[model samples]
Target chain A: MTNENAITVKNLTKTFGDFTAVDAISFEVGKGEVFGFLGANGAGKTTAMKMLIGISKPTKGEANVAGFDVRTQAEDIKKSIGYMSQRFSLYNDLTIKENIVFFGGIYGLKKSVIKAKSKNLIDELGLHDEADKLVGSLPLGWKQKVSFSVALLHDPKIIFLDEPTGGVDPITRRQFWEMIYREANNGKTIFVTTHYMDEAEYCDRVSIMVAGKIEALDTPKNLKEKYKVDSMNKVFLKLARNIE
Target chain B: MSISIKNISKSYGKVKALTDISFDIKQGELFGLIGPDGAGKTTLFRILTTLLFPDKGEATVADYDIIKDYKDIRSHAGYMPGRFSLYQDLTVAENLTFFATIFGTTIEENYDLIKDIYMQIEPFKNRRAGKLSGGMKQKLALSCALIHKPKVLFLDEPTTGVDPVSRKEFWEMLKRLQKKDITILVSTPYMDEAELCDRIALITDGEILQVDTPQAIMQAFPKTIYKVRTSETYRLIKDLKTYPKTHSAYPFGEYLHFTSTDENLDPEELIHFLEQKKHTQIEVEKIDASIEDTFMELTHTREVNAHD
Candidate 1:
């Protein structure tokens, strides 16, 4: 079962001082599954993602991401996964192409390969005009698109995107999802976290966290059925209402 | 009108934030200003709240002109900017006390008004506002905004970056606040939140695209929309775009929301077409248009119009 599972978890937990940030949570994700990690602010989504990504050590339990043990094989896990975090993850001062090149280089991409990939990406996104422009000068939507492209540069097995569509308009959000769907179609597993319920519906499976615990995990359609709700928003509300 | 905007326009030197924006809000109604980033929502909000001046036209809040009676408007208006703006060094209780004191009131006097929201964060009243969680900070900010019991409340993207559970809770709080007979104007980029308002005005690139109840807006959609899916969704959009009858094709959650110019189209026809294209697991079902669909339709036309 573990061999086929893209990600396998059992009793993953994390704590900070007196607070149990991420309670014991277990789940299995298939290859190419767009697994959504959703929760209210302070609901332990970040803590749990960190553990799975191998940046933060777990307080207890066992979990594997991309067939690498999060505890003992952190380096292997790091090399096999891509990340597009919300903050301090991208260089605003660098040009669009430089940012891509830097990310590719850090992933150990060869210089010649980085140059070739940068050219191809610039052409693909039709950003040849802004190749030398500072990423900070670009619009929010454009910045997100470029950052997403950078995340895919290394072609990691699983990509972790934290609120990639936040603050962008509906059109841009849809375009971003299209990119995600394209990746998933190519058998790349996508792990995304977002606050928008409508975006949750796009995920193949979604996990709702509440008070440091996984309160619900099912296909968006099934979760709606289980909660007797028509939308993911109401399902989240139902789960959160039970919390203190 | 509880609020009125007549041909209001604003510019920041070379950039036009809002252009000839006009709308009206009835008394005690929850109105939404919907747009994406750089769509001039914040500029419009600033002008309506009397914090910034418009280059042309006029607006009124609580029947007080934005320019002539700005003092009156200021006294009766409560604003929560998209960005959290509170004395970060101050504790939750301290910030509430400071805001209330500046409004010539006391926390005890307005405790009942903000009690529901405050009680949720009261446990951490001693923590610095900067150290509070995102949802808690937003709730506290709302409490501060309401301490003065303003007749009008303006919240700019209050739920942005907040989680779904917290977003639901926040909207519920707004519903409860509406019971006080206060007219509310809230702006957000998320289209789903637009449906919660009594009425919404969809804005894009500094212009009002449409204004109506969410239900009415959905019904106003001119085309029959269908949610279609096939084995290879990556190619679904491209393939549909090439179909001679395809009017519009866009990827939604698990399916593509498609429309065809052909009249009385059957799902079988679409499935048969896709199967012929060597696609498997074809599923096509007619679905009602969502607010987002309407928004995209409205904005999509403008994209073409801009070319002309």
Candidate 2:
């Protein structure tokens, strides 16, 4: 049955040699949902995300993202999803417009479509003044916004952001989240991982991973209430401590 | 020991790393250097700790010039770099001992200062420094930094990669260390952490943006702020920004922190405007400005003023 859920996993597990990076986790993300995947450093959030994006194979269990089986339809899954990593993945030496065109070319978009979309994105993000500037010359916040817009160049069904706002200022982070919310409103699912607990509150639902396991998964309000905490930061602390 | 920085400036080729930055850190004060990455926080820390010399300006630690008294400065201060620089292959105990020996002091002499932080990770003292968890590694690094009982401690983003709980625990440790009357200078990117500092200097792009107590900074916010939560938060932000009376509308927590160009704009009028814009379940009330809000306002104001 094709439900509203964009992603579905059952007993998903990922192991590297003897180490189980993601241990039998299961979750579902609704269409157009902003799902926050949160955990401390070295937790299984990235591993699970890699499995969902079909980059890493799951040792056991079944998983489907964007309605395709992760193992058998890995290529199809890749085409249907966009990913922005914590590390800036764009070429630093290239100009802003050049980078977007290059990514569009890789995705096999028509030159006209690339041009039109690039203009729209540049206008939307107010990057017109810096369009010809080298990506390396731009500030961290602008580069991140460009990276995110580049990720969505192909109009994928879902976007996976791994710690997208790692080092940006609060104002920039707010602006970034605004862009994410805009994408979600356009019926694109956003699955993101973040170390910033405050950012997790912006998600429709969030999953807290600890020790390769999903310790908590729910709306921010529900999780906060369940943990008897005032903020998502406090809730995460309680859960992380308990896991340890 | 007190710290004084005068007209400090550094550049890498054409890019100015720090620009005429000047600040004085009182003795035994838990002074915080708050800024984003590439804000010259690390450069300032390195210059203070005598690792790097500034092309311009002078600094003194405990009454000794940073350049002429490099040895004394190095011996009198402990520095925990942003990145874990301890020997990865060495065990926690070995690393601690190594740092202690480098300073010509044994752990026994400074054991009382680091007893609290060191005790937490003592059980895993045999584990390699690289093998420890982020929190554990932080504690071990901190303990090693304190192993020599330096007069002043310099920690550069010590809680960057650690968890929230660990960050809180680390701050508590600093508080305890403060009681011993050892001056501490910590730099952090997290705005929330600034409130924990006795006094904070907000740095950006190698410029000292503002330096004050957290409360003083918050009080200096030049606008009347309100928290607005609505069912249509995304649209509400857009709509509020378009409002003629609105000065700024930014997201904070679950609500949007908004300020108006007109101070006389009342809550009822805001609710009416939002309702007119089809926003449901609207909640609007005047609220206290936070350090993040204050910093954003200051920085944005600076940008605007510069443009003018």
Candidate 3:
């Protein structure tokens, strides 16, 4: 069932002992939309993301990701979504081809499909020459691109990118965004997070979390207008001004 | 000069980390080494901080030779590495005290020096360093680095991955530190932060690309950039790249920054071409080059030069 909303959350929350990491929050992400999830560090964005991605249990509330309940169908949710983070994505010691095959197998793809997808990915990324080279030897930008491709190996309908282009060069950052746009155009719902406010403006909608609560949620244009700021950076600064 | 480097180079086996790096920081000047990951910023910082040695050439920090007087530099310089190096199990106040004792000084001795920054996190002084938020951790790290009141401060990517609000505050603290006659050498990946420094050196791929004030560097961009926007962003980038006269096209927030190979480029002609391609809501405006634009251009030129 391909519902209009790829993700629906109502009062989703997570707590640790006496500390409420993610307070009661609610939101929905539509299909084929780019949703920017932004917040200050330790603002509970990570805690909330963990619950939605099917790794951690929520302390309270309800969320459905890709038509699967987060609490009951976490395995199905994991199968329906692709995730790529800058810190942990691919094995550096493995060759590019090997990493591709390994990830494809993890995603339960067949051997023949893994072989064919690996070829197409290498050719598309122009990494044919480096396919046999250790992933650790590749440049940071190239590695990031390769990691993102591997995340999409199983062709998930929704993708989650956690700072995929962090600390990358300017040109490479733009190139990564271009890849994001191509995927979104292909009808994949993109849920991404980034410290770079420029990337925020590219999303169809954005939600800013502050102190374990969603402080603002709207399109970038509307958020800018509401905050009376010319840029998302200014809006963020304005909202996070009172943070401890 | 607070810090002087002459043709310093370093290689990690086959990989060259720094090549012919030369720069000098004035006393009390806030100097920035701006670059992305894999740049030689950290390598140079390590050399200056006396944590690592350069294979060729020499450097001096606070009038002490990096090689001959490495021990003296250790006491005279305060370095905050990119990675958080403080003991996570220790409380915020304990970490500060620990660093102060190591430097043969006390936090009470330099209370006036770090009052502004230290006070911001003093409320959580009893919290474990591991339990602090990202911003709080950074403040504790900085306070510990400054507990000795060293003559020179070297911060490597201090604001990397920090939110905009905290990053701005951190730079403001740096501006105040510069006024206290403490020479500040900071490195960052954010190009916008480069403008906050009195002078900046743009390094990439282990080589310095340009060294100048942010204003001067932007002035020498050598291209007329136009902010172009339309409905289909992805298509616009592809079509613009395929254009014969296009020099560069990259995303700049809500617009695609376009530059032409020819000096006398006409925006009207570009608009007409996009209209033919069925792009609606077309807007094209001439804009000044930003530090990011200049960086990409310089890196691209370096690649082209390498090809030759």
Top-DockQ structure, candidate number:
3
lDDT by residue (A61-147, candidate 3, tens digit) is: 999999999999999999999999999989999999999989998999999999999999999999989999999988889999999
Instruction: Give the Cα error of residue B60 in candidate 1, in Å.
Output: 2.2
- The true-structure Cα RMSD of candidate 2 reads 2.1
TM-score values for chain B across all models: 0.97, 0.97, 0.98
- After aligning candidate 1 to the native by TM-score, how far in Å is the CA of A18 from where it should be? 2.0
Q: lDDT by residue for model 1 over A63-140, one digit each (tens)?
A: 999999999999999999888865645788999988988899899999999998999889988998999999876777
Give the Cα error of residue A220 in candidate 1, in Å: 2.9
Cα error, residue A239 of model 1, in Å, equals 2.8
lDDT of 2 by residue, B1-308 (tens): 39999999999888899999998999999999988777789999999999898999999998889999999988888899998888999999999999999888999998999899899999999999999988888888888888878899999999885668778888999999999999999999889999999999998888988999999998988889998999977898789878988888998778899988888888799899888888888998888899889878877887889999
The 10-residue segment with the lowest total lDDT in model 3 chain B: B233-242
- Candidate 1 clashes between residue pairs 3 or more apart in a chain or in different chains: none
| Model 3 residue B251 distance off true place after TM-score fit, in angstroms | 0.4
Candidate 3 regions off by >4 Å? Answer: A1-3, A242-244
lDDT of 3 by residue, B84-191 (tens): 999999999899999999988889999999999999999999999998988898998998888898899999999998988889989999999999999999999898
Query: Which residue pairs come into collision in candidate 2?
Result: none
Cα lDDT tens digits, model 1, B1-308, are 99999999888887788999888999999999988888999998899888899999999999999999999988899999999999999999999999998899988887888999999999999999999989899999999999999999999999888877677789999999999899999999888888999999999889999989989999999899999988676788878978888877887766789988886888788888898899998888888999889988888878878899
User: What CAPRI-style quality would you assign to candidate 3?
Assistant: high
lDDT of 2 at A86: 56
For DockQ, candidate 1 versus 3, the one ahead is 3
